[model samples]
Target chain A: MKNLVLASTSTLHGQEYLEYLLPLIKSHFRDCSKILFIPYARPGGISHEDYTATAGKAFEKAGLQVHGIHEFDSPHEAVKQADGFFTGGGNTFLLVQQLYRNDLLPALKEAINKGVAYLGTSAGTNIAGLSMKTTNDMPIVYPPSFNTLGIVPFNINPHYLDPDPASTHKGETRETRIREFHSHNPQPVVGLREGSWLEVKGKNIKLKGDLTARIFEAGKEAFEVEPETLLNDLN
Target chain B: MKNLVLASTSTLHGQEYLEYLLPLIKSHFRDCSKILFIPYARPGGISHEDYTATAGKAFEKAGLQVHGIHEFDSPHEAVKQADGFFTGGGNTFLLVQQLYRNDLLPALKEAINKGVAYLGTSAGTNIAGLSMKTTNDMPIVYPPSFNTLGIVPFNINPHYLDPDPASTHKGETRETRIREFHSHNPQPVVGLREGSWLEVKGKNIKLKGDLTARIFEAGKEAFEVEPETLLNDLN
Candidate 1:
């Protein structure tokens, strides 16, 4: 059975890293002693060692050892053999680019599909989708393709923020950007609010967290799905 | 000599479309009776005809005729023969992709470098840079390439926003995002605020408008440049 946790953001406002999701993460990786962390996204351009250490500290609280995947000679082999996969949040373009560069997409996909527990936060959650077209990150780097691991059927819009009606900025709102994504791609997109996560246990993908998720599909008005709703049936 | 107006946005808060910059736009295109409008950016998903009509109305205020580039059989030929070019703002990726598809990048670049009056707002302004990698727009569409006009030596981050000091959003700030961009790309980037525009008169590109512009270099600290400052000297 496929086992995965895709979270919108790693930290909520005023919360520590992985603080809110720690309990769920501890339970999700209960059986594993170690989790491989992919730090290629490099949030704020942090080093892989530093980013991995950050993950290491959080996972230590959960009593699990964390290792940076970049330390291994063969990232592909590491994914194939690891007991778990933990891709942190940062730039999705850079993450996808490295995954392709190291030829780790297929191996990671196969590993997760074959039951290796997977945890993705922010950029990590984005790669679990069919494509990274709905990401809110800047195009700081150009990836080889917008495609990602289709571990889940639909796409994800992570760190999903609703339009600030009070905002006077002329930049397109998050809703407008997602709407434009539908203009080019018909795939369903889930705007997972901060603190939201999708718990994929085999075919049952339930929306976790206290807040509701906004779902948008081509040709249909966007609607909100409740916290406990299952998202497996979404097209 | 390059004669181009690269604006941060088409409209400012509480103002009509191109209202604040209409005077400069009219005078820039003083020798032209008609301007070819590029609407592939499609702000808010407006159609080419509709977006062009919006531009037509604004230009009509300046006693000039307007034509949508899509109306012409050969968009390339249209750019080559046009007295002026106007690329509206929307999605930078979509604009770059359409330019490549219609093979209009070269023509537009050549015409602008040849001293034809050019006006670009938002996405249009983004394409005036060395590459689209610094764009603040969402990656709603994957363009064939991130390369752009390079009419100006540096990249442009249009609609440059200062982080809200009072907000609690944990997502990376605009400054943080641009720093990450420098981590990957060493090119210089200019942050064009909402009310700012870059006036490219021959070899000198000066920052225009009432607001100051932010200048970001690959390794140096980001600093502010006052209005009327010549940007050609920036690295």
Candidate 2:
């Protein structure tokens, strides 16, 4: 069984880090007091220790203590013993690279499968999908593979933005990029907008937020899945 | 000596393929009658043969003949004997992947060094830089390396977009992505907006177009370079 909060972003516009997610975090980790923070994403090229400190301040509001995975003797052991897990957002490539480098993917997946409370924002949420193929993050570093935890049946594109109708920029839109991904891959994808998240408990996954999430399946017209919709195996 | 026209895009908004660049193309390859087209980028998942034919029609308007590298018995020899070269835009990952798989990087570099007139747009322009690290394209596929021609002293973010002040999207802006790249890399980057290009002749490279190009340097404030600015060894 899985218990996860995969959010589109860590911070929303005009909000502090994880501020909007505090109440949800409190309920998610109500039975636990400590969280193992994986700060490898390093948003803005921040250091792991620095990123962890930032996450710690946010976790404190939820009445929890945070420990960075970097402080442990082994990342695998850190996952094994964590009361809960939280991976913050940053460069997806660097995050995936570090996960492979530390051999933490399998361990983290196993832990989450056993119902360890988990929270993933942005790049963190991306890795919970079938692959990191749909991430909008720049490839600052090349990971050995695009494969991820597959906690969910499909891929996720976080912070998904609608195309600007008035803009003249000719670069492919987010929808175009995801369509291109579909051209080369068979996996379905969910475009998760900011302030939106998917709550997973065992085999049930529900869209939880004020906004509707766009769902993209191969050879099908892309459509929106409304808030609170049960979406597991919908593909 | 090198002769190149690295464009921000193959076709500007509301224009036919290579229409705006035809006059420039005519002048760049004034002495050549035939060109070898490397249609490896495969924009929008287009096929090599189909993309090559499209380039052929565009080159015909400039009074030049187009031959795809795939048509030649030896792509290496085709590069050595090509009167001119044109690499179109598509997925950067696939383009670079094919380039290495076909062993065309060195040959193309050698040809460009020997003063072959060359044209690149979008992903094509990205590879003309020190690396493809600054590309705005998604990672649909993984190439053997991020290394590129390094024909220019810096990296290039083609179809460079400025942050929209009116929007509320939380995804990292293009500027932020480049800044993050600078954190892990020492390479300078040029944000070449649509309708902009770099005109490279031997040791001199000039920014051309009506808009100012944004320049990003490591460990320093990013600035803008005016059109026609001489950029060789500017660092």
Candidate 3:
């Protein structure tokens, strides 16, 4: 069965990287001895090797060995052979650009569909949905397309935040941005807040974590979904 | 001479639409009686007519007539005939998409280069730079390209925000986002804080308003420039 853990962020406030998701990671990839890391996202513009090592240290705590896809002679071959995968978050534009340049998206999608364990955080989580249009990241680079894995029927707005009642910043709020997305896209969107994640087992998709997620469907008012709510057929 | 006012935002905190810029607007377009408005950004998904009306109401206070480009039978013709222009803030992706869809970019650039007075706020201001790569707006839609007018030598980060010392949000800060853009793009970026603007006269560009603007040059530490500082040769 297909299995995945798509999280809003790799770290919560005042927490170590992937610290909150370690327990879930250990259980999700229990069957796999090795996990391949896609470090194209490169948070803070860190080197691919450095990003991979960060992921490796975290996965090691769960008794799993991790290798970066960049280390392989062929990224496509790396995706095909890996039993588990993790894509760290950074600039979605850069991540998408690198993935397209390497022609690794197809193999990665196929591997996930074939039941290889997968974990995505932030930009990584944003790509698991219908499109990357709902992402909050800046357009640091131009990708060939906005299409992604579409492992889920809907899109994801990771690092989703509620509007501050006191502040007066003029930038579009997260909710406004998602509604703007609906102006051009028909896909539904899930606003996943920090410390929350989606757990997918086969065709079943459930909200995992204690917080409630905001849901945006075209032509309908945005509403909240409680934890453990099934979201596989959100559309 | 070429004249333009590119502001970080049209509205300031607790201020009416364009309230903070009325005097500047009056002096900037003193030579023209009518202004052609580009309402493609459509803040909050407002209709072009309504957004144009909003601009009209604001510009009327300065004794200037305003009409939306959408109201014209040919947006291209509208750009060519208008002596002054204003592109309101909205989603940059949507604005760029509509401009490209109507094949209006070249004409618009030509008109501006010919010294037609122009005003841009937020997303509109972002397009006056080398590219739309530094905008903070969500990618609600995919544009054909990230390229913009190149009326200026650098990119503008409109409504530029400082990182909140108290907030725990994990989303990339404005500075981090711009640095990431530098990773792929070579253009310098100006972080125009709220209420600050750039005044372009012929070949000269100067920072205006009470606040200092942050300047980011690739491979160098970001620094702040005082108000009224010359910005035309930032690179």
Candidate 4:
């Protein structure tokens, strides 16, 4: 069975993101020898060996062998040797840049299509969508916004949170910002709040989070759906 | 001369944006009869008629004839009857939605290529770029992110203001948000802060605003440049 789990970030991962995957990781990959980790998304100016190590420790605690792809000469070789792939997120743009520059997106896409279990977080989730246009980050810099791996139809806005009241910054609120996005957009967007994730098993896309993900279509009010809602179920 | 003007939409007219365009509008169309206004971008829940009125009044104060394209049956006809076209701001997604649904982008692009002066502000400026991926608004909805008029190679993030400390509502600060975007992005992005505009005259893309605009390329620090800086001059 082809399985995919996407989270907001490796840093943000905890009971919320892991609860849904821990059982599966143990049950499915119990006899599976190794897991490949892609740590090439270092451009968010925050990627460190310690960060990747921490994430590896999580899987190690779950009884899986984790190997960083950076240790291998080629991503293809790494993928070929692994039972599954775990992609922890940092910045979607940085992740995609590394993926594209090294020509790994197509290879990863091929791996998924070939039935590899794929796990990703924030930036990883953004890459799973049709385009990076829906990311919550500002246009600080531009990567190939049009060069997503095309894993899903709609874009994912991960680490989604409501505007905090204690902070000071003048601009639209998160909801308003999203409303602004919907106001002009002609396509539907999935706003996955923090602690929420989307899991793909076979052809079923299930929402896994505490809050209902917001959906916005052109010329309509943004609406929310319960967790585990299937993408095929959305209009 | 294929002239293009981008305005700042703070007060909607007469002040920052129109002050710069009035003299140019008068000088460029001295022998021409009238200027056309395209006001279909009312998606931000803002007033489109009022926004257009601001431009019309500004042009009238300059002793130039201004007519809204809503008065015409089709944008093509509006283009044929006028010497130039001015697109006022609101929600760019809405404008692009109307343009795409009405199939007006190609028509506008054709008109600009045919030597008609094209002017845009905020959302209007967004359409002139290669894509709206850099816009500061929420991705509330999806228009055709691929259907921009392609007048410029990079995307425009308009109404682009720095984070203000005076208000209280917490998310990422605008600068942080933009930095986050840069962290992920692998391409160059033009961050056009409020009161800033870009002037495209023939092949020259000049920045015009009170403060320097911010530019970001992959894996580099964001740099700022003064007004009228040529696009090619960016390195």
- Clash pairs, candidate 1, are none
Ranking by DockQ: 3, 1, 2, 4
- Model 1, position B152, has a per-residue lDDT of 94
* Candidate 3, residue A149: lDDT: 91
The DockQ scores of all candidates, in the order shown, are 0.79, 0.66, 0.85, 0.19
- CAPRI grade, predicted model 2: medium
TM-score of candidate 1 relative to the true fold: 0.99
**Between candidates 1 and 4, the lDDT winner:** 1
RMSD of each: 0.9, 1.6, 0.9, 6.9
Question: Which candidate has the top score in lDDT?
Answer: 3
**What tens digits encode model 4's per-residue C-alpha lDDT throughout A1-235?**
5578776544432343355557656765576676787876543455546556766777776788778887788877777767788776655555666677777777788777677878887767777777775666543333444457666666677766666676333234556655665544444667787667788877788888677887766677777889968885543
**Which portions of model 1 miss their true places by more than 4 Å?**
none
TM-score computed on alpha carbons, candidate 3: 0.99
**Clash pairs, model 2 backbone:** none
Per-model TM-score, in order, reads 0.99, 0.96, 0.99, 0.61
Can you write out model 3's per-residue Cα lDDT over B65-136, one digit (the tens) per residue? Answer: 998999889888989999899999989999999999999899999999999999999999999998999998
* Model 3 lDDT per residue over A1-235, tens place: 8899999999999999999998888998898876889999888788999999999999888888899989999888888999999999999989998999999889888989989999999999999987899988889899999999999999999999999989898888888888888888898999999989999899999998999999999889999999999997797
- Local accuracy of candidate 2 as per-residue lDDT tens digits, B18-130: 99999999989889866889998787677789999999999899898889999999998898899899999978877898899988999899989999999999999999998
Can you tell me which runs of candidate 2 are displaced by over 4 Å?
Answer: none
* Model 4 Cα shift for residue B194 (angstroms): 2.0
At residue B52, candidate 4 shows an lDDT of 69
Error of 1 at B230 (Å): 0.9
